[model samples]
Target: MNSRKQVASSFTSATQIPISKEILETPVVTTIVSSSDEEEEMSFEADLWVSLTKTGKQKTPNMIRNDLQKYIDECKENGTSSQAKIVKSLAVDNDSFRKFMNPKNYPDQWSATKNETYWAATKLLEKVKHEKKSTKVATVSSARSKRKTSDSPCISQKKTKSELRSDLKALIARVHAVPNVAQNGGVYDSCTEVVAKIKKFLNRDGMTKALFLEAVLGGVNPHILAKFLAGKKQDQCETIVYRTAYVFFEKLRILEGRKKSKARNINEERYPQGFSLTKK
Candidate 1:
């Protein structure tokens, strides 16, 4: 019995969810901030669970459920359930529909993400239900209109770093905007500058993927990801994200050490216990 009142494993409660497609695609175990300044993730237990579970295997664990999934194990008495099951049921659960859709009725501390999750679950169900017949005119046109900039050549509109950091896609745009001077004789930004900027903008969660993506790969270039991030069997997206972050933070350890050393040096010149070192 989930004390929160176990929701039915359905997706009816979700509607008009406002989350972005990019956030939906990211792996849930994503690092937000480094301990010293950055960090790594996607725990083995979660991976193992995904390997063993049959539900929602289509999407990466990095999305939303990782935060909401652990209760499933505790919920064993209710029988094995995945976030997918929960959202699928919520989609149509009339009680949830009320709580998620109406702001005035929102449960205490309940973010609108609940609605977003349901919407994702609903779309997922629809996709699973209709796996065939991809040749549709209107659908194709509609999709083209919504095409992600990351899927192709970068088309950047100028935005402040603050604006870019506020949203992942906006940050992606910043990462994508590494103008190639050789090709277009545009302004060239060194990789170091970009990495520094990314590290500065991210929060202290030590879980953000933006820092590592830029530090190792120059940026989360979707074009490059096709060549290096995917393998024949499992996707290496989460692997690279953590691997690079690990290395990035390991280097930061040196910075942390230096900071301590500087403090020690200042302390080394301490005044005599009872008397001042400086002449009166």
Candidate 2:
């Protein structure tokens, strides 16, 4: 009767073990799951990287997650949980990850630090950078070619002699010394010389009336000269010439003063006292 009771007790205990616990304790047959999952994720990254490089389009993590969800599910079903885990971690939804993946979508949030997806993303980013550099170089090359073609003397358009002469004549007429030229021989000579110089300047291909005025006026305001040339204001040639010369001379004097000051400092540094033979 005791032996019978022992058997009953053992059977009852065995039966009490939960079905869920048994399922948990059951060993899976897959042994290379960890290694296989890594390999699968690597393969997925390579394929995705190729897609990214070709399009130059930023892929959001959500978009990437959606695309890989099926593959991850299949891996998980196949007991390649490690591989699925890797893929899931790569597609982890976070602000930093999202910003890194689709920088164009969230430019302000963009960050470029090394992370779990750095290697895969770098493949695409590097390719994009190279393509942009190549495109920029090509654009610059095309622009330089255009500039060279346009700047070539044979290709450059030039004003006709008649047009140049007319423009120069108008420019001179605007700056002429009113009735002073008839009264003063010096004024008449200067006027004649100015006309001759303008004619010579117009005969050149590259020279313009504005350029000639710029040369004559040195650093003076060209717009003021332009106004006078346009006949919007009146000023005698003698007055304009005297004023320009005065300004030019004044600039020269200022420059000379600065040079003298620098020389005096250097001399003092060298001598340290009066250099004259007669002592104070």
Which 10 successive residues of model 2 have the least lDDT summed?
27-36
55-121, model 1: which lDDT tens digit per residue?
4222322232342344434445567666446555444464564455445653322233334443343
Candidate 2, superposed: residue stretches over 4 Å from native: 1-56, 83-114, 118-280
TM-score of 1: 0.20
| Estimated TM-score for each candidate | 0.20, 0.17
What is the C-alpha local distance difference test score of candidate 2? 0.39
| Candidate no. 2 TM-score | 0.17
lDDT of 1 at 92: 49
- Candidate number of the best lDDT: 2
Top-TM-score structure, candidate number: 1
